[model samples]
Target: MHDPHSERMSSTEQRAAAGLAAVFAFRMLGMFMVLPVLATYGQDLAGATPLLIGLAIGAYGLTQAALQIPFGMLSDRIGRLPVIYFGLLVFAFGAGLAACADSIWGVIAGRVLQGAGAISAAVMALLSDLTREQHRTKAMATIGMSIGLSFAVAMVVGPLLTRAFGLAGLFWATAAMALLGILIVAVLVPRPPRALATREAGVAPQALGPTLRHPDLLRLDFGIAALHAILMASFVALPLALVEQGGLPKEEHWWVYLSALLVGFFAMIPFIIYGEKKRQMKRMLLGAVSVLLLCELFFWQFGGSLRALVIGNVVFFAAFNLLEASLPSLISKVAPAGGKGTAMGVYSTSQFLGAALGGLLGGWLFQQGGVDAVFLGCALLAALWLAFAATMREPPYVTSLRLALSPAALQEPGLVERLKAVPGVADAVVVAEEAAVYVKVDKLQVDRTTLERLVEPAPAC
Candidate 1:
């Protein structure tokens, strides 16, 4: 029979996970809503050159990358809800500013402000605070799905919205969404429960040293950066290519985006399932990276053919979705238990940095070398990522568990040693003042019943 405690824990964790994901999706939707239409829309504004248009499109990423870590640290001091509310307010302000802008430079400034609202790191840290260690991976996965869904929706909706109401209207809508998000934060999300609010002793700092010094973690971080860079760079070129070479109108670009997203979603599921269930995550990741490289190569080879471009887009998005979902999980698995938050903070920062650089660099490259050179740059990034990815060790599946014990129990000689010796327990640490035990265990082999029995009510009590 299944344990009721376990079931109840699972359900609560799922709710918290879903709630956090909704928050992320709502925020991302506002940002992504402009990407598909930005290049064309910028033409209507004053001083709208290709470089300025690219700046408007990617400026948010620059601010986001710069502020992610600081926002996370701020959350640690001022609390998650306060930081999130501040971010939402900043985002709304930027949206409203962009909506009123008559110049491309003004819009670019607004986008930079929008990016400064960077709350992803805070959101992830909040998830860590709310959920048990055993369920953190599942929670993060839900957030990943929310991001992917938001991106897909934004790609389809961005062009249509641009056609229907124009760029200003879209920005106004985004402002409205951001305002709504603030309401959700206030009315919907629960206050952090007392048990979850208690900090564990011995948890290490999540700093640049730990995040960047580890070879494997650094590899994953670089991959995320490169992946996002390619994505942003592709957007800089693809719209013009579609209109000029594919003979597609600007408004009809939505159809291409919708089709690619749909096809990619369906095609990626089998590979993702295979990776998780068959323990072939490493191999699948490498394969996905290879597919991305191939897509870049194809784009380079068939720059003028609409059919070939569409095919390449489908393959690219499929791989992009797969990597987006898997990379965080891989980071969580491989990171030291004490520093997962730091590793993720670093990863998120790198991702936005890449986005910012992609747009700026893509604009320059497109202007200088045209479409072929753009794809060549993307291919080179993918090649470097593939090499680094190939060298990474398969991440072991482990989960962390937090247990509160009496001071006497902790003082009991060899208590931690005994826990460490338990069948699946990989490591255990006892924090005396907190009267807590942090345990790392292999997911498949952990015997919850055995651990629970050890902590059962004392005879006198």
Candidate 2:
């Protein structure tokens, strides 16, 4: 048996992981930079209504939602880098077009083209293709952290960048970043050592049934969608509210965002630690959703007070950050061992679609009844989610592990049970067709050395 430790990440893996994470960050930053200021700068565009402004803000999600899965599947058939390059080209073109446009409709058209790039899944797949199994989790986690960091940076930078160059300048900068991503893919990311012999790691048609029918996973999907919808939808009114209620300058809003985000993030740490340590994830999750509902109510109650607005920002973001960090792990716990990727793809698609819906609906509400109406809508969303989520069972206190397998393990009828018998393993599933076994285990209880040996097959005579 090949020593499990022998598969340490090579230089190529190190470079690929770093390069791909940077690439994902660049693209995400471009999309997010507009969020904090769109309601303000969108006013300068021709024929802009509150509704159309909201549509432009979210137009990218419409195309992104429609194409995310198809691009992932397409990458499998055609090749990862080719699809990525083409998508980047579309994004750059869209960004450039938006930069040059004078009208809101033109910006909307460009955003649709931008979303047509839809290369997130392809990039993630490329990350998988480039890294060893042991390093893949670390690689994916790095990319995830980059995304979260990018959003925080965009909040602060968007207003500053707009102050310097106006909204079109932001679009031009996005186009430049997209071009840089193309260069990164070509130069920084290394080609896989060999062509993949199978598509097992990619989402498959067979996994669709089990993933689709899952009640708990579906609830998580709804939660993610609701999360993003509230996020985008709130932007439709948040900035304007800050200006009208607090008498703050438009650019000055960044201070509120940056400070609130920092405090909110720090506030979330203890909850996360306590939830994990005590196996009380369900309780904290419910608490977070309830906080979301209250945040909206607080916004309505104190929309006119500057001090209250700042405090409200901190609390709202605190709750948002908590749920944002927790939801993915919750979904992973509920997903079928073999169908994790499919379930995540659906989750992502729902998230993008929710953004589109929220922007459209949120804008309409603001136009009809003002900030109070917008928050009321968000509160209703939170209420609905709370009602459904209340039915969910507590998340298992386990983390997932992936181990390489050999063909011989497929013929061992009792292998899964034997794996399950391992003291710390809550369950095990072997995908013989994929030459991999996945397990859920409590790290505190698992005997690491024993599990490592089991992951490798017995040497043949």
Candidate 3:
């Protein structure tokens, strides 16, 4: 049987995937840069408070979540490049506006605008457009890695940049990066080849609805949203907790971030390997969610101590990495083939929206009930995710088969029926016009020799 995951990506597809991943990382870097320093920076702005600062930091996610799918669908209508160009322009404008802002409210407005770019969904859809069915997961994984790397780098760099040049200066630099991204999309990225581009029209709308309604998909979507919300919310709380509660200096917070990230990165490797290689994805995901839930509870209990908080951070990051890596892969496996883009579009939107909501709610919770409230809230969200995740069925391993057949054979009566009789063929769709057969089969049960024989040319009469 053919192995879909083993299929090699063409050079062009690799380039497109790499380019888009870089673009995504660049944009995300700008967003994450403010997380570590937002509270201190807020003090410099007019009408700044802890609650408002959290909102300002998180406002981008709210807008991005809301707009991600709309932008993605727009890409489908106009073209990917046009939508990407528009998003970059919006991002640049938002960054520039924030750079010039003198008040916390002004920064909040800027963040909201920044989120309005919502280019992630569009970029992902474009990636799917550029890659073949078999190679799409690898492309998506590349993008996922960029996101994780961007966040890690931003945490280390955000504080250093704030110390060197202040928050406004950082915003100005982000604006420059956004402008550069626009130029890259316009000039560096090649347009999709004609054959690949034409297939967009054949993608049906029904696939979108089913994916959105899927219980498993919704669970994963909610998981992403909650994960980001907790992340953003934690940043809102962590810096203050470290400085005020833990006696750590503001300038030295980067050390804490650096350590947590290093530990999280290395710790996540084994679990990720087990999930992908051992086929224990569901079990691993559940374990991670359980860990997150327990971590939140521990944070609620032992948040007063610096060491406790540090240990909590370690656990949180480990779970975060696992969930981040696994969620999209799960979506790819479960999403209908034709509407994979739409499914991801919805998933991305939820993720951003969750980040925004987490910020808003976390800020409000901090104001109303202090650090305990935020942890309790996060714990509750994680519990819900864990429960939902537990109910999800394990997705089977999928493999796609491509067969070359003669037009004469396809035209012959009962040809399709003959092909269907081959052992271990779960589903077969013959596109005679393309001289290809698309087959879904159980990799363990299917025999390659048997399949080849079924499609072999007939002997001379």
**Relative to the true structure, how large is the alpha-carbon lDDT of every model?**
0.80, 0.84, 0.78
Write the number of the candidate with greater TM-score, choosing between 1 and 2. 2
lDDT of 1: 0.80
Candidate achieving the largest lDDT = 2
* TM-score, model 3 to reference: 0.86
Considering summed lDDT, which 10 consecutive residues are worst modelled in model 3? 194-203
lDDT of 2: 0.84
lDDT of predicted model 3: 0.78
TM-score of candidate 2 relative to the true fold: 0.94
User: Per the 3 Å backbone cut-off, how many clashing residue pairs does candidate 2 have?
Assistant: 0
Pairs that clash in candidate 1? none
RMSD of each: 3.3, 2.3, 4.1
TM-scores for the candidates: 0.90, 0.94, 0.86
Model 2 residue 209 lDDT score: 80
Which tens-of-lDDT digit does each residue in 1-461 have in candidate 2?
33446456777877898898899999999998888998888888998888888888888999999998899988888889899999999999999998899999998888889999999888888887887666777787788878888888888888889888998999999999999999998899999754342322356677788887888888888998898888887888888888888888887888998998899989999998988788898899999999999999889877787888889889988998899888877766766665667777888888899888888878898899988888899989999999989998887777667676666666767878898988878878887666777777778898555776876668878
Error of 3 at 123 (Å): 2.1
